[model samples]
Target chain A: MNNVYLYNDSFNELISLIFYLLKNNIKPTNIKDVSYNPNLFEECIFLGIKSKEQDINNIALQFGYYAFRCIYYVYLSNNESKELIIYYFILNAIKYRKKITYMRNLKCVHETLRIAEYVSHETHKMKGFTRFKEINNNILYAEIEPVNNILELVSKHFEKRLKNEYWIIKDVQRRLFSVYDKKNFYIIPEENLKLEDFRISKEEKEIKEMWQLFYKTIGIKERKNDRCRMNFMPKRYWKYLIEMEDEL
Target chain B: MELKEKLKILADSAKYDASCSSSGSNRTSKNGLGNTAIAGICHSFASDGRCISLLKILMTNCCIFDCKYCLNRKSNNIKRAIFTPEEICEITINFYRRNYIEGLFLSSGIIKSPDYTMELMIKTITLLRNKYHFGGYIHAKAIPGASEILLRKLGSLVDRLSANIELPTENGLKLLAPNKDSNKVDKIMSYVKEKQNRKFVPAGQSTQMIIGATKESDLDIMSKSSSMYDNYKLKRVFYSAYIPINKDNLLPTLEKPPLVRENRLYQADWLLRYYNFKVNDLLNENNPNFNILVDPKTDWALRNIELFPKEINKCSYYDLLKIPGIGVKSAQRILKARRNFTITFDELKKLGVVLKRAKYFITCNGKYFMSSSYFKKEFIEANIVLEDKSIENTKIEQLGLFNE
Candidate 1:
C-alpha cells in the first residue's frame, strides 16, 4: 500500500508524516527524508517521495511550535472550541511552511499569548493548592498531574519553599519529574521506572521528620472549617499530600 | 511543655481570626534558597475543615483586654502558651522545608502592651526573613494601638498585612469590645494603607470585620467595607460571622453562626468588585439587609426588573455581567462564542451560564421565555429551603418519613 499520510488542507499532519515515512521502510536520518531530487534525469516522470529526515524533523519541530501557540490562544480565551480551532490552524500552518521564522507571525503569536495567560493562571492556582508529603525514604515527594504544562511553574514554587532541601515534584499523568536539590532544579523524563526505586539521602529523612512534627502542631481544633478547606485544597489532591491521607 | 502542645494551644487560639489567604507577592529563589509561589499553599486542614498552610499561631493567648466576644478574652478560662521568637522561626523554617507550609501567619494577643506584642511579632518576622532566609509569604497582623514605627517595620518584611477592623461601627466596638476603639483601629488601618503606598506590604492591606456581633445591620457592615475598599486600596475585606464561643451579657447567645448571611455578604462583595455594584444598590433604608431567600445579585435584579431581557448581541460585556449567575468567565465565554454564532438558550447553557437564575432576566432571539406565572409561587417556595425546619423536614422526607 502507498504510504498512509493523513493530510488536511492546513499543514497539521506531522504525526501522519512521521507514520508514513516509517511505514515506507524509510529511516529519517536528516531533514530531507521526503524531498524532491532536482538533479533527476527524468524530472517530469519521477515523483520522488524522498526527503532528508532532518528536513522532516525540522518541519515537525516547527509545527510543534505552531501547535503550542494555538493551544496557548485557546487557554487565554478559556474557549474550549478555540482548542479545536487551534489544532486545525497549526495543522494548516505546518503543511505550508518550511521555515520556523515564517510560522512565528503576529496572528499565531497573539493567539499563543492568550492561551498562555490562561494556562499560566491555572498553573499558578495549582502551585498554591499542590501539597507535598514526606515518605519513609526521606524524599520530599509531591505528585500533581495538573491539566496543563505547569511543571516549570510549580517546580519554581517548590524550589523556593523548600530551599535548603532536596525534593521531587512528579507529574504522574505525564510521568515527568521536576527534581530539586539544595542547589538547582532539573527535569527528569519518565523511563518506565517507579519513584521508590530512586535513591534518597539520609538528611532528607531528618528534615521530613521535622516537617511532619511541624504540620501536626499548627492546626487548631476550634477553627476547622472543613467546607472552606475543601474549597481551597480539594480532595482530588489528597493522595500526594502526606498528612491529608489519614484525615481524608 | 513540648512544642507540639504549645502549637496546638496557639493554633486553636489563632483559628478564630479566619483570614488564611496566602496569595499576593511573587517571590522566587535567588540565593539558591526559598521561593514564594504567587498562588499560596495550604498544607493541611483542621478539624473544622480550614486549610492550614501557614503556621497560624498567636505569640501568646494571654490578653489584658476583655473583648466579650473573644474566646481568649482575659476573663475566659483557657490554657495560654507563648512561643519565643526562636521557636516560631524554627517551626516555620522546618515546616516550610517539608513543604507543609508556605510561611508564617503570626498573630498575638496583647501579652503585656500592644507595642511589646507588636515588637515580638516584628522580631519573629525579621528573624524568619533575614536569619532563616525565609522568602516565603508572611501575613502579619498589625496590632491596634501598636507604635507606628513597629507597624512600618513589620510591613517592610511581610508580604501581606492586615488590621482587623473588629466591628462595623464605633458603637459596635464599644458594646462588644469595650477597650478597643474604632478610631484607633481606623488609625492603624490608615497607617497600613500609607505604608502600602510607600512600597511596603506589597500585597496591600486587608482588614476583618466581625459580623452578627453587636446588632449592626448588613447595610452598616457592607457600607463600612465599601468605604474601606474605596479609601484604603485594600487587597481584601474579610467578613467573619461571629460565633459566640464565650457567654457574655454584651454579646448575643446564638446556637450557630449566621453562615448564610456571611455567604450573602461574600456574594455582595464580589458584585461590588467585579459587577460594578455599589453598596446602596444592594441595600437602602427600605431593604437594610440582604434577603435571606435569594442572592444579592438576583434580589437586585428582581427589584429592578426593567433591566431584564437585554439583547445578548447588543448588550455590552458589563451589561451582560449584571445578570445573576453570569460571572466574569461566563460573560467572556458568551462574548467569544457569539462572535462565531448567535447564542441561543441551549448554547448559553453549554457556555456554563446558570439557566435557572438567568432565565428570569435574559432572553434568546428577542423572545421572552420566563413569565411571572412560572416563578411567582415556585420561586418563593423554592427559597423556603433557606429556613431551618424546611431543610430538616426535606432531609427527613428524603429518608422516607411520611407518617410523621
Candidate 2:
C-alpha cells in the first residue's frame, strides 16, 4: 500500500512531517503540501503533526547539517518532484550519513543538489534585482514575484545590508510581506496591510524619472542586443522593474 | 543646471568604460545605511546586455588632453557638465537606499592638473564616507600623474582602484593619447601593489585596454595581461572594443565595434585566470589572434588533439577542466560523483557536462561516447561549428551591416 502525506506549505510543518516519517520508519510513496492534488489510488494521510524547536534540532542532529540544509533548500525549489526527491534523499542520508553526499551519481542525490542550487541561484539574483521605492514618511517598499519561497532568505540578507531602514518586501505570488522596522522583521499576511495608506513621495517621482533616464542612456547604442539583456534579466522580471517598464 | 541634465552628460561619457563589477569587497554596515557583499551583486542589465552593478558616472567631462579615440576629448564639440561633491553624495545615497545600484564608480577627465583633479575626487569620496557614513562599495579611478600621497589617500577610502592602460602598446598610446605616459600608469600600479595591507584598496587594482584601435595581436595582449597579473597582482583586466566616436586618420573606420574579438579575448582571459592555460599555450607568433569562429578552448583542444579521449571516470580534475565544455564547477562535480559510482555518458549530462562539445574529447567507462569518425579533426571542427551557429550568426550579421 502506498501512503501519501499532505500538510500545509510551511517549512516548519514540512520538518515535522519528515520527523514523523523518520521516527516511525514509514516510507512515504509521495510527499506533498495542501496545494497538491491527489489521485484515487494512494491512501492520503493528512499530517497535522507539528514538531517543536527541539524536534527540529534533533532532525538536524540525526541527519548532518549539510544534508539537512540541502533538504530544506530542495523543499523550497519549484520542482514538482522535489518532495519525493527529499523523501528519498533523507532516507539515504540517514542510512549512509556523510557518505551519501558524495554519491551524486544516485538519482535522488543528484536531484536534491541540483534543485537546491537552482533555488539559491534565484535568491542571489533576487538580492540584486529587488528595487525599492520610497513611500510616505520615508518608508521603503519593494515587490517581487519569485519562483521559489525565498523571501526569508532575501530578507535575512537585507537585514544585515539595509539594517538602518524601515522597509517592506512583498512577495506578490505568496501574498506575504517581510516587514522590517530597523531592528526586527516579521512575516505578515496581506490582509493586515493598508493599501491606501501607502503614498508615493513627490521627490520619488523625480528620482524615478532620473533613474529611468540613466538606465536608457547608460547602455552603448552600438552594442544593443535585446537577446543578451533578456538573458540576464529575464522578461518575467520586467513587470516589477521600473527601467524595464518602457520596454515592456 | 538641473541634476538630471548633468547626469545625462556625465553618464553618457562614462558609458565607454567596461568595468562595472562590485565583487571583492566585504565591507559591512555599522550604524550606516548600506553594506558590501564580497561576492558582488549586479543591480540591472543594460539594453546592450552588460551588467550594471554600480552607478557609473564622471565628476566632469571637461578634459585637458585630446585623446583621439575618446568621446570627451578637449577638441570635441560637446556639452559638458560637472557635479559638486554634495550633489554626488545626495544622488549616491538616494539611489543606494532605493537599491538601484550596488555602489558608485567615479572617474574623471584631467582638469587643470592631475593633482587638482585627484584632490576633487578625494574630497567627494571622503565626504561620502565620513559625513554620510556610507559603507557601500566605491571604485575610484587613479589619475596616472597624481602624487603618491593623493593616490594613497584615495586608495584607503575606496574599495577598488583602476588606471586604464587605454591602448596595448606604447606606440599606440603615443599615437592616440600623446599626453598620457605608460610609465606613470605602471608607477601607480606598483605603488598600489606595495600598499597591500588590506587597508588600501581591499578589492585590489584592475586595468582595461582598448582592443582593435591598435595593431596589437591576441598574443601581445595576452602576454601583457599575464605580466600584469604576476607583477601587479591585479584582480581583473577588462577589454573594451574601441568604438568609433571621434574619427581620426590614425583610427580604423569600422561600422561597428569588434564585439566578437572582444568576446574571444574574454574567453581567453578566463583560460589564463581559471583554466591554468598560459598565453603560449593558446597563441604563438604563427597564430597571433583567436579563431573568431569557435571559442578559445575548443580551438586549443583541436590544435592539441593528441591529449583527447580523456576518461571521465579516471581523469584528474585538471584534466577534466581541459575538456572543451567542462568548466571548473562541473569538473568538481564529476570528480566527487565518480568516487561513489561510475559516471556514464548520460549521467555526465546530468552532472552539467556540455556533452555536445565534450563528446568528441571525453570517454565514459573506457567506451567512446562518439563514433570513431569524430576522431578526425575536420569532422569534430565541423560539428562544433554547427553547434555554435547562433553565435556565428550574430557576429556575421553585425559585421555584415558594415559591408553593405
Candidate 3:
C-alpha cells in the first residue's frame, strides 16, 4: 500500500509531512499540495508541522546555509514536483553532508538548482523592472506578474531602498500585495486590494513621460540593435517596463 | 526650457559615453532612501541597446573647449542646457525612488573652468546623499584639471569616479582634443587611486578611451591600457567605438562604429582581469591587431596549440578558465563537482560549459569530444564555433555580457 502525504503551501506543512512519513515507515507514492486537490482518498496523511528553526536546521544542516536557501527558494517556485525534489535533496544531503550541492549530475540536485536560479532571476529582474508611481501624492504603488511566487524575495530589497516611504507592490497574477508602511513591510495575500485604492498623481504622470523621453533620447541611432535589447530585457518583461508602453 | 526638452538634450549629449556601469558597491543604511548591490542593478535598456543603468547625463552640455570628436564641444552648434544642482538632486531622488535608475552617471563639459564644473557636481551629489538621504550608487567623471581638494570632496560623496583618457596616444590627444592634456587626466586618476580610505570611491576609479578615431594602432591602445591598469589601478577601461559625428580632417571617415575592434579589446580586457593574461599574451610587437574571425581567447588558444586538449577533470581551476566556453562559474562547478565524482562530457554541458567551443581545448578521462588535430590552426579555427560572426552588428550583446 502506497502512503500519500498532502500539504498546504506552507513550509511548515511540508517539513511536518516529511517527518510523519519517516516516522510511520511508509513509502510515499506521492506528496502533493492540498491546494491543487490532487487526491481524494489514497491513504493521505494531513500534517501540521509547527515550524521550528531546529527542525528545519535538522533537515537543512548537512549542506550549510546556501543549500537551505536553495530549498526555501525552490519550494516557492511554480514547479509541481518542487516538494518531492526538496525531500529527496535533503535526504541525500543528510547522508552526504555539503557535497550534495556540488553533485549537480544528480536529478534532485539539478532540479533544485534550476528552480532556485529561476526564482532568483525573476526576483532580480523585479527589483529593477518594478516601477512605482506616486498615488495621491502620499503612497507609492507598483504592479508585477512574475512566473514564480517571488514577492517575498523582492520585498526585502525594496524595504532597504525605500525604508521611509509608504509603498505597495501588487503581484497582479497572484492577486497578492506586499505592503510597506514608514515603519515596516508585510504581505496581504489574496483579492483584498482594489484599483480605486490608488489615485495617480499628475506629477507622477509628468515624471514618467519625461523619463520615457530620456529613454528615447539615450539610445544611439547608428547602433540600433533590437535583437540584442530583447535578449537582456525579454518581451515578457516589456509589459512591466514603462518605456515599452509608448512604443507599442 | 521644459523638463522634457532638457532631458532629451542632456541625454542625447551623454549617449556617446559608453560607461553606464553601476556595479562594485555594497552600500546600505538604516533609514536611507536607497542601497546598492555588489554587482549593481540595470534599470532598463535603451532602444539603441545600451543599458540605462544610471541616469547618464551631463550637468551642462555647454563647454569652454572644442574637442573635435565631441558632440557637446564648444563649436558643435547643438542646443545646450545646464541643469542646476537642485534639478539634478531632485531628479536623482525621484527617479531612484521610482526604480528608474540605480544611481546617476554625472559627466560634464568644462563649463567656464574645471573647478567650476567639478564643484557643481560635488554640490549636486552632496545634497542628494546628505539632504535627501539617498544612498544609491553614484559614478561621476572627475574633471581633469580640477583642484585636488574638489576631487577629494567629490570622491568622498560618490561610489565610483572616472577621468576619461579620451584618446589612446598623446599625439591623438593633441590632434583631436587640443584643449585637454592626457597627463592631467592621469593626475586626477592617480588622485582617485591614492585615496587611502576604502569608503571613498569604494568601487574604485575607471576611465574611457575612444578607439579608431586617430592613427593609433591596436598595439598602441592595448599597451596604453596595460600601463594604465598597472600604474593607476583602474576598475575598468571602457573602449568606445569611434562613432563619426563630425566632419573633421583629424577624425577617421567611418560610416559606422568600429564595434568589432571594440569587442576584441573588451575580450582582451577580460583576459587581463579574470583569466591571468597580460596585454603581451594577447598582442606582441609584431602581432599588434587581434584576429577578426575568433574571440581573443579562442584566437590565442588556436595559435598556442601545444597547450591544447587539457584533461578537464585533471586540469587546475586556472587552466579550465583558459578554455573559451568554460567561464568562471563553469570552472568552479567543474572543480566542486569533480571532487565528488569524475565529470563526464554530458555532465560538463549540464554544468553550463559550452561544449561547442570547449571540445577543442578540453578532454574527459582521455576521451576527446571530437577528433580535431591541434597541429593545424585553420582546422581548429574552422571547427570551433564562430560566436562573434553571429554577433558582429550588435554591440549590445557585449553590453549584456559585460555590464561594466
Candidate 4:
C-alpha cells in the first residue's frame, strides 16, 4: 500500500509535515500538496499542524543550514512533484547529513538543487526586470508576474536600496503585493487593491517618453538585431517592459 | 535646446563607446536614495542586442579636436548641446528613482581643455553625490591630458574610471585621431593602478580599443589586451567594431561594421580572462587570426586532439575546464558530483555539461560517449553550431552622420 502525505502550501507547513512524519517513523511513498489529486492506489494522510519555529530550526540543525535553505527555496517553485522531491531529499539528507547536497547523481537531491536554483535565478532576473512608476509623486509601484513565489525575495532587495521611499511590488501571478513604507516591508494578499486607482504621476509620462527616446537612440543602426535583443531580454517579459511595449 | 533634444544628441554621440558594465561596486544606501549591487544589474537591452545598464550619455557634443572617426569631432556639422551640472544630477536621480537605469555613465568631448572638461565632470558627480545624496553606480570617462589632481578628485567621486585607447596601434591613432596622445592615456591608467585604495575608484579601471578600423590583426589586438591586463590590472577591455562613419583619405569605406571579427575577438578575450588560456595558446605567428569557422577554444581543442577523451571522473577541475562546451560552473559541478557517485554519460547532461560539443572530448568511466566514427575533426566541424552566421549575410550601409 502506497501511503501519501499531504500538507498546506506554505514552507512552514511543509516543514511541520516533514517533522511529523519523521517523528512518527512513517515513510511516505508519495508526498502530495493540498492542491494535488491522489491516485486510487495511494492512502492519503493530512497533517494540518501549525509548526513551531523551533521545529524548523531543529530540522536546519540536523540537516545543514544550506540543505534546509535548498528545501525552502525549492518549496517556492511551481513544480507539481516538488513535495515528493523534498520528502525524498530530506530522507537522503538524514542519511548522508551535510554531504547529500554534493551528491548530484541522486535524483531527489539533483531535482531539489535544480528547482532551488530556478527560483533564485528568477529572483535575480526580477531585480533588473522589475520596473516602477511613480504614483501621486509619493509612492512607487511596480508589477511582476514571476513563475515562482519570489515576490518576497525581490522586495528584500529593494527594501535596502529604496529605503527612504514608499514602494509596492505586486505579484500578478500569485495575486499578492509586497508593500514597503520607508521603515519596513510586508507581504499581503490582494484584498481590495483597485487597479484603476494606480495612476501615473504628472511628469511620469514625460520621463517615460524621454527614456523611450534614449533607448531608441542608443542602439547602433548597423548592429540592429532583434534576435540578439530577444536573446537577452526574452519575449515573455515584453508585456510589462515599457520600452518593449511599442514593439509588442 | 530642450532636455529631450539634448539627451538624444548626447546619447547618439556616445553610442560608439562599448563599455556599458556597471559591476564590481557595492555601495549600500545609507541616508541616500540609491545603492549599487556588487554583481551589477542590466536594466534593459537595446535593439542592437547590447545591454543598457547605465544611462550612457555625453555631457556635451561640442569639442575642440577633429578626430576623423568621432561623431562629435569639431569639424562635424551636427547640432551641439551641453548639460549643466545641475541638469545631469536631476536626470540621473529621476531616472534612478523610476528604475529606468542602474546608474549614470558620463563621458564628454573636450570642451575648452582636458583639465577644464575633467573639472566640469567632477563638479557634476560631486553634486550628484553630496547635494542629492545619490549612491548609485557611476562610470566616468577619465579625460586624457587631465591633471593628476583632477584625476584623483574624479576617481574618488565615481565608482569606475576608464580612458579610451581609441585605436589599437599608435600609428592608427596618428592617422585617424591625431589630437589624441596615446601616452597620456597610459598615464591615467597608471594613476588609477597606483591609487588603488578602497575608496578610490572601487570598481577599478577599464579601456576600449576600436577593432577593424586600422590594419591590426586579431593577434595584435589580443596581444595589446593581454599586456594591458598584465600591466594595469584593467577590469575589462572592450572591443568596438569600426562602423563606417567617416569618409576620409585615411579611413577605409565599408558597407557595415566587421561584427564577426568583433564577436570573435570578444570570444578570444573571454578565453584569456576566464579559461586560463594565453593569447599564444589560441593564436601563434603561424595562425594570426581566429578561425571564423569555429570558436577559439574549439579550434584549439581540435588542433590539440591528442589530449582528448579525458576521463570525466578522474580529470582535475583545470583539465575539465579545458574540454570544449564545459564552462566553469559545469566543471565545478562535475567535481562535486563525482565525489558521491561515478557520473554516466546520460547524467553528464543533467549535471549542466553541454554534451553536443563535449561528447568527443570527454569519457565516462573510460568509455567514449559517441561512436568512434564521429571522433574525426571534419565530423565535429560540420556539426558545430554557428551562433551568428546571419549577421554576415545581411548587408546594410548606415549613412555617415559624424564624418560626412
Candidate 5:
C-alpha cells in the first residue's frame, strides 16, 4: 500500500509531516503539496500528527545551510512535487550529510535545486520589478503577481531597506500584503480580498510619468528588441508596471 | 524649470554613457534605505533589451567645453538644464523607494568649471548619503583635473568612481573633445587607485571609451583596454558606440550606431577580465578586426586548430574555458564533477557546455563524438557558425545519422 501526504503548504505543517513520516518510517509514494494531487496513493496523512519545530529545525540544519535553505525555498514554490522532492532530498542529506549537495548528478537534489533557483530568480527580479505609487501623499504601495509564493521571502528585503517609511508590497494572486511601518512589518492574508481603489496623487502621477519617459527615451532607437525585452520583463508582469500602463 | 523638463534634457545628455554596472560593491545598509549586492541585479530591460539597473541621469546638460560629438556641447543649439542638490536627492530617494532602480548613476557635463561642477555633485551626493541615510549604490564620475583634495572628498562618499576615457586613441580625444586630454583622465584614475587605502571609492575605478568615431582599429581598442587593466587595475573599460548627435568634421559620418562592433568589443573585453586572456590571445597587428560572423572565442579556436580535440577527462580548467562553447561556470562544473568520475559527453552537456560549438574542440575519453568529416579543417571552417543553434542541432542530428 502506498502512503500519501497532503498539507495546506505551510512550512510548519511540512515539518510536522516530515517528522511523522520519519518516525513511522513510511516511505511516501506521493505528496499533495501545493498544485499536486495523485490518485495512486492508498493511505492519506494530514497535519494532525505533531512534531516539535525545534526537532525539525535541528535536523534541517544538519544537512548543510544551502540544502536547508533550499528546503524552505522549495516549500515557498508552487511546484507540485516539492514536498516529495524535499522528502527525498532530506533523506539523502541525512543519510550522507553534506555530501548530497555536491552530488548534483543525483535526480532528487537536482530537481529541488532547479525549483530553488526558479523561486530565487523570481525573488531577485521582483526586487527591481516592484513598482510603488503614492496613494494618498506618503504611503508607498505596489502590487505584484509572482509565479511562486515569495511574498514572505521578499518581505525581509523591503523591511531591511525601507525603514522609516510606510510601504506595502501586495502579492495580488495570493491575496497577501506585507505592510511595513517605521519599525516592523505585518503579513496579512485576507479572505476574498480585493485591493481598494483610491485616487493617485498628482505628484505620484508626475513622478511616474517622468519615470515612463526615462524608460522610453533611455533605450537606443537602432537596437530596439522587444523579444529581448519580453525575455527579461515579460508581458504577464506588465500589469504592475506604471511605465507599461501608459501604453493603455 | 519643471522637473520633467530637466529630466528630459539631462537623461538625453546622459544616454551616451554606457556604464550601467551596479555590481562589485556589496555595501550594506546600516539601518538605511537600500543595500548593494556583489552579484548585480537587473531591475528591468528597456526596449533595447539593455538592463536598466540604475536610474542614470546627468546633474546638468549645460557645459563649457565644445566636444565635437557631444549633444550638450556649448556650441550646440540646445536647451540647458541643471538639477539642484535637492532635486537630485529627491529623484534618487523616490525612484529607489519604488524599486524602479538599483541605485543612482550620476554623470554630468562640465557646467562652469571642473571644480564648480564637482562641488555641486559632491553636495548632492553628500546630502543623499548623510541626511537621507541612504546606503544604496552610487557611481560618480571623477572630473578630470579637479583638485586632489576635492577628488578625495568626493570619492569617500560614493561606492564607485569612474573617469571617462571617451575615445580609444589619444589623438581621438585631442581632435574631438579638444579641452580634455588623456593624461588628465589617467591622473584621475591613478589618484582613485592609489587612494583606496583611505577608503576612497572602495569599489575601485572604471573608464569608458567611445568607439567608431575615430580611426582606431579593434587592435587599438583591445591594447588600450589591456594596458588600462594592467597599469591601473581598472574594474571595467566600457565601450560606447558613437551615435551622431551634433555631427562635426571630427565625428564619423554614420547613419546609425556601429552596435555590432561594440558588441564584439564587449565579448573580447570579457575574455580579458574573466578568462585570464591577454590581448594577443585573440588579435594581433595583421588580424586587426574580429570576424563579424562568429564571436571572438570561435575566431580564436579556428586560428589555433592544433589546440583542439582536448580530452574532457584530463584537460585543465583554463584550457577547457578557452573552448568556444564552454564558459567559466561550465568549466568549473567540469572540474567539480571530474573528481568523482570521468565526465562523458552526456555529462558534459548536462554541465552546460554548448556541445554544438565545443564538439569541434572536445572529446569524451578516447572517443570523438563528431565524425571524421568534422575533424577536417576546411569542413569545420565552413560550418564554424550557424544562425541559431536550435536549427543547427536538427541538421547535426541528421548528419550524425548519415555518418553512422
Candidate 6:
C-alpha cells in the first residue's frame, strides 16, 4: 500500500513545509484530525481565512496595505515610477521577512511622501465638506460617505473642536462610527441600524432656534455676496447645515 | 431683550470675519461637561455657507470707533445688541449641553471704549471657565488698543486668540479704516507674541488681513504673512478677500472680490508652512502674484525645469518636496516605503501621486517617463486644451455626487 498524505489545499503549502521535518516513525493520521502544533514547527504561520467567499477579501487587505504604501512613496518623491518599484519591493519583502524597514533605505521614501501629501490634501477637502445633524438623544450625529478611508482623519479635527461634548460620527458607507465620550475615543462597527428615526432633545430645539437666529443676523442686508458665499460653502452642503434646511 | 433679536444683531456683525476654523487645540474633560479631542467639530452652517461650530457671536455690535470698512462702524445705521458676561455664559452653556455648538468664538465691536470691551470679553471667558466650568475651546478676538495685561488675561482663558490686521498695508489702513492705526495693530500683535512666548496664549495666535480692499499686491500679502509667522509665531494668518459690503468711495467697487486669488493665497500659504518654501520663492520682483492657471508649486516647477527629474532613490526629503503635486504626507510615506523594495513608476500611480503634474518633475533609475512628451511648451498647451474640454463638459453633468 502506498502512503499518501492528505491536507486542505488552503494549508497545503504550509503543511508540506511542516511535513518535511516530521518524525519518520510517525504516520497513519487523518488530515481532519490534524491540529496546528506550535511546538512542531520552527516558524509559526497564522493564516486568517474566513469563509470561502471571504478568503479573497482577507488576502486583499494585505495587498491593499502594500498598494497603499507603494502609492504613498510615489507621491512623496513627486516621482511617478516609485509606486511600481514599491509594489515589487512589497512582494519581495513579504516573501523574505515580516519586517520591511529595510525598504526605507532603498531611495523610494521621497515618492511615498508625495503620495501622503495627496491623501492628506483630499482629507482636508472632505473635512470642510462633511456635515452633521442634531439627533434627539443629545448626540451630534453626522453621517458622511467619503470616497476614501477618511473617517479616522476627519474625526480627529472634530473631536478637538467639540471637546466637551458626546458625539457619534458615523461613516454610513463603511458601517463604522467613531464614538467620543468626552474622555476616550472608540471606533466600532455599527450593526444594521437605521439612523433616520433618532430623536432630538428639547434643549436642542431651543439651541437650533438660537443658531438659526444667529445665522440670519450675521449677513449685512446691503452687502450680500451670494457668489463668494457659494464659492466657499457650496449648495451641496446646504442640506446638512441647520440654516439651509428651509431651502433643502 | 428677546434672545432672537440679540442673536440677529450680534451674528450679523460677525459675518465679515473670515476665520471660521475650529481646529488646533485639544482640551478634554475630567469631571466637567466638555472636551476638545484634537479633531475639530462643525455643528451647523450659516446662510453665507460658513461652518457654525460655535455660537460665534459678538458681545456687542455697538462701536465707538468709526472704522469706515466695518458694517458696525459707529456711523453706520444698524441695530445694535450687547450680551452681558452672564448672557454669553448662559447661551454658551445651553447650546453646548444640547450639542448645538462645540464652543464659543467671541468678538466685539468697541461698545464704549477698547479697555471696556476687552474687559467684558475677558470676563465672559473667565466666567465660562471658572464659574460655569466650560472646558470647550474658546477663540476670542484681541482688541487692538487693549492693554497687555488684559490681553494676557484673555489669552490664558481662551483656547485661541486673533487680532484682525484689517488691511495688508499701512496706507490701506489709513485710507479705508481711518479709526484703526496700523502701528497700533502691529503693537498688539507684538504684545500677543511676547505673551505667547511667555506662556500666555497656549493655542497660539491668529490674525486676518483683508485682501483687494487696499492696493497691496500679492507680494505685499505674502511678505506680511511671512513676517507674521517669523516674528509673532502666529498659528495662522487668515486672508479675508475683501468684499465691498458698504459702498465706500475708498474701497474698490468690483462686482466680486477675487475668490480664486484668495484660494491661491491659501495654497501659497500652505506651501510656506508645510513645503519649506519661502514668500520670495512664491513671488519675486517681476511676477508679484500667483499664477491664475495652475497652483504655486506647479507654476514654480514649470519656470524652474532645471530641478526636474530628481532621482527618486537619491534625493533628500527637502529636495523631493519641491516637486509639483508632492506634499508633506507623500514625502513621509516615500521615506518609509523605499526601505524594503525598489519602487517603479507603475507603483507610484497606485500610491496616488498626481502623475500628470509630477511626471515632468521626477525620474526613476535615471529614466524619464510620462504618458505624453516631456517638452514644456507642448505639455502646457495639451494640458490647457484638455482642461478646457473637461470644464466645458462638466457644465452639463449633474452635481449629485457631492450631495449629502
Candidate No. with top TM-score: 2
Candidate maximizing lDDT: 2
Question: What would the per-residue lDDT of candidate 2 be over residues B130-223, giving only the tens digit for each residue?
Answer: 9999999999999989999999899999999999998878898999999999999999999999997667899989999999998999888999
Cα deviation of A163, candidate 6, in Å: 9.8
Judged by lDDT relative to the true structure, which candidate is superior, 2 or 5? 2
lDDT per residue for candidate 5 within B321-391, as digits (tens), equals 89888889888877877776677887676555678778878888877886755686666767765545556
Q: Sort every candidate by DockQ, greatest first.
A: 2, 3, 4, 5, 1, 6
Tell me the tens digit of each residue's lDDT in model 1 across A23-105. Answer: 55453322111232334332222223344456445544765664444444343343433433443444445554433222222
lDDT of 5 by residue, A59-90 (tens): 56687777878888888898877888988887
- Model 1 chain B worst lDDT window (10 residues): B377-386
lDDT of candidate model 2 versus the reference: 0.89
TM-score, predicted candidate 5 vs. hidden true structure: 0.92
Candidate 6 deviant stretches above 4 angstroms: A1-203, A215-244, B44-50, B197-199, B371-373, B381-389, B392-404
Stretches of candidate 5 off by over 4 Å are A19-25, A34-43, A58-61, A192-202, B387-404
Every model's TM-score = 0.77, 0.96, 0.95, 0.94, 0.92, 0.72
- Clash statistics: count for each candidate: 36, 0, 0, 0, 0, 74
Off by over 4 Å in 3: A1-4, A22-25, A39-52, A193-197, B371-376, B385-404
Interface RMSD of each: 6.9, 2.0, 2.3, 2.9, 3.4, 6.4
What tens-digit string does per-residue lDDT give for candidate 6 at B140-206? 9988888878987988887788888877788888887888877777887788777674236667788
Predicted chain A of candidate 4: TM-score: 0.91
Candidate with more favorable, higher lDDT: 2 or 6: 2
Any runs in candidate 2 off by more than 4 Å, and if so which? Answer: A35-37, A52-55, A58-63, B390-404
| Deviation from native of the Cα of residue A11 in model 4, angstroms | 0.8
- Summarize candidate 6's per-residue lDDT along A147-188 as a digit string, tens digits: 555677777766664656677887777799888887666777
Write one digit per residue (lDDT tens) for candidate 3, span B94-124: 8988999999999988889999999999999
TM-score, B chain alone, candidates in order: 0.90, 0.96, 0.94, 0.94, 0.94, 0.92
Which 10-residue window in model 1 chain A sums to the lowest lDDT? A1-10
The TM-score obtained by model 1 is 0.77
